[model samples]
Target: MKIANQISMKEIAKLCDVSVATVSRVINNNGRFSEETRKKVLDTIEKYQYNTNTVAKALRMKKSNTIGIIVPDISNEFFSTIVHGVESFFFEKGFSTIICNTGKSKEKEKVYLKTLDSKMVDGLICISGQEEIEASLLSRNIPIVTMDRRPKMTNNLAIIESDHSQGGYLATKHLIEKGCKNIIILTKKNRLSPDIDRMEGYKEALTEYGIPFTLQSIVETTDHPKGNFEAAREAIRQELESGRTFDGVFATNDWIALGVVKALSDFGKKVPDDVKVVGFDDITIVKYIETPLTTIRHDVEKLAEVTSKLFYQLLTEKDVLIKQKHIKIPVELIARKTT
Candidate 1:
């Protein structure tokens, strides 16, 4: 076929002696087509190199075959690992992902959610740090799945989270078993379930060991993901300046734990020998720290696997029944030099 101008699907259909819809079906590999007709369309496409506008086609079909992912921070190892897991699964399923980092800002989160909704994404995978967005998400019947922390429980919603309470207990109990008492916790002040649950677990462990829980022992830090490092450093510095004594420290995440270790080092204190430190979320780099951190491990790969599987069932299977909206993955203790 000889072409004088830029070719479109319409021109290809004309050359193939078929309707535009038939050419579209052949192009998208959807619907039924006779073998002979398929050959003709393909031949014409090859000869002219007719280009199809995917955006227009998606608009016409009302499906973009793309999933939007919203995360609090992409720089954090724990959340980034989860994103990697999501991308691996969706890549195998032939779906594209659009990742948005909110940086734990409610305004940015709302904007991203609204934009994703407007873009007509196939589904949403959210590691939501913003609590207010839950009500609006629940109002619509969307195929949305949340990971890590969630705001509220809804019947149709699917949530994937770690066993934070168990992780907290494990981390705290490990410090106590190392013969350290007067333990302090450095955690986020946010209402996110993970932080709160972890604190509760810390308390449970303390109570079990006949150690009294004191409000002064809990230090609240910035809710921003990256801000947590500095928050931990500042909190520990202030506690030390106040002459408050803490033989052990439990950090909600590895970053905060690192901060605690650093601050303690600045004050001429040795880890495990002076003040034992334990962290949650056994991020990869934790093992390489100067003093390898004793931390709690939650499998990000498993979280990604279950989340993608549940979302796929909701997206494809009409009769698929999800009996539970909230699912918790178990956590394990990884003992290292710090504890």
Candidate 2:
């Protein structure tokens, strides 16, 4: 017996010639449905205006068909591109993405995690977080994908990242080939695992070229994004003030490279003529810059595409038995006039 003015899901299913399960799948988006079937069902619902309003109330408790993407900093070009890629991919598959900008804060991250759980988000994608996800989120079998970050514990999770070590090697090696014997490597604020690997590559290049990997050759920055540019500039200025001579600079990102260039110019040094510069993550501006920054290029779109595919695989492939799966996207060096 149905309640007053209540039309059953069975009625709607029969009207559209699809099983109740198909309607449920369409509602939740956890399962697949043909475009034709989806249109038919939606059209029928619109035509009839199922009693008790949209679809059936019983079907509302299932998957939200929404994904939460937690990024450390959305302002960064790298992360913004990543968010765009993931959002575009999921939007086409009947899924909506809820983007949470943590601003690289541990407390904010914790808040987003608990909030997502409260909202019953189907899955989560964490991008470049310094802190690990709370183990409580992992207790449930929630599908997750992270970029260049490994959460504390995991079950069904996928990791995607660029080849940082190789990029660092290529950048440093190119600088060395350009006759830069004394080179300074400017590390990014809040260095992730990939950055650590990049540092290793920098060291490798120095070792191969018989250049000593001394403390003077490395300048480490902290977690303040707003201060990164000024900080890099100050570091270089200090190095110059201390009579420390460096013929080249390898900034972890293009933004930092800008600071390095300005600092060199402040001391009346000519770029490439007196001090060559290279950076990581060849952002769009690198090409048109006055010096045409040489940088390591990473494919953000590919990273997003692969991450979305891996996430869907984790969501659908129940028997695959995934454990700590990691995927690294290759990187290339965009050789410009900076080197």
Candidate 3:
């Protein structure tokens, strides 16, 4: 009786008098299909109430229409927004997502990968977690996409990342243009790809403008967005106590940038007049904040769209030479009150 209750895609296709692939396209709302055909299939689906357990169907057929997403911290607005973008695409394509939060722990990331592997997830979308272990997973023929960070191994991997170095260059260049000297930067201690590339861009800009770069000018935060407010506050407090002077500040991410703003406010300093600030990843909240942040903007939706298309192609197409190895999205500088 339980077996009889389970309906498959093939059954729907047969009932609708259409090819299984055509039915799949209609179900996923992909490609071109005649309106009459779409209505015919949807009506049949409505009549039979033919809801398939995608997981069980996938397991029986040796294909899981599901993917694993590993992120450093889901609470962070940047990562959360990106996850939303990825999920939206996958959901529209009749796939389920298993999201895991690692809290920036490599061990936790490894454990999650193992769990996902056992479940036979079709692919993985990793957002800036463990590198070495991820490379190992790729070696075992896992279809993986890395976002906001590059995987250590490039062979047969798809990377969706922003031009962080260009973003950093733009932010620092803006501060230099504002006639501000003695600029400081807030970043992560572990030096993830985003941090490392942004720092490089910052240094490049300073060098171009003939401003000397100092080691003391760079301060490391907790690398996690949740703790960054207090981290920035403390860093600023120490700098103030030690009488360090700076007229400009650049943050690796928007959260750290907001932290810098709050720290400056606590010190009774005025933005632009005392310390002009610029940030990376123009997350939504920054625009509505007390002082709208000046930031580098990259489209999360576009990144997800590209990633989803590539993943689908890899899953469907056996032609290895036709795939793109890397995708780097551009960044734009948004000038606002903070700058």
Q: Which candidate is the best by lDDT?
A: 1
The residue pairs that clash in candidate 1, if any, are none
lDDT of 3 by residue, 269-335 (tens): 9997889999888888999987999999987777777877887777667655534657788889999
- Report the error of model 3 at residue 113, Å: 0.7
Once model 3 is optimally superposed onto the true structure by TM-score, how far is the C-alpha of residue 293 displaced, in angstroms? 1.6
The lDDT values for all models are 0.81, 0.80, 0.80
Q: How would you encode candidate 1's per-residue C-alpha lDDT over 66-105 as one tens digit per residue?
A: 8889999898887888889888888888888999999888
Evaluate residue 75 in candidate 2 and report its C-alpha lDDT on the 0 to 100 scale: 86
Candidate 2 global lDDT? 0.80
Q: Candidate 3: global Cα-lDDT?
A: 0.80
Model 1 residue 306 CA deviation (Å) reads 0.8
lDDT ranking from best to worst? 1, 2, 3
TM-score of each: 0.80, 0.80, 0.79
lDDT tens per residue, model 2, 156-233: 677789988888898999999999988889986567787788888899999998999987678876544467777788
Model 3 spans with C-alpha error above 4 angstroms:
1-61, 135-140, 222-226
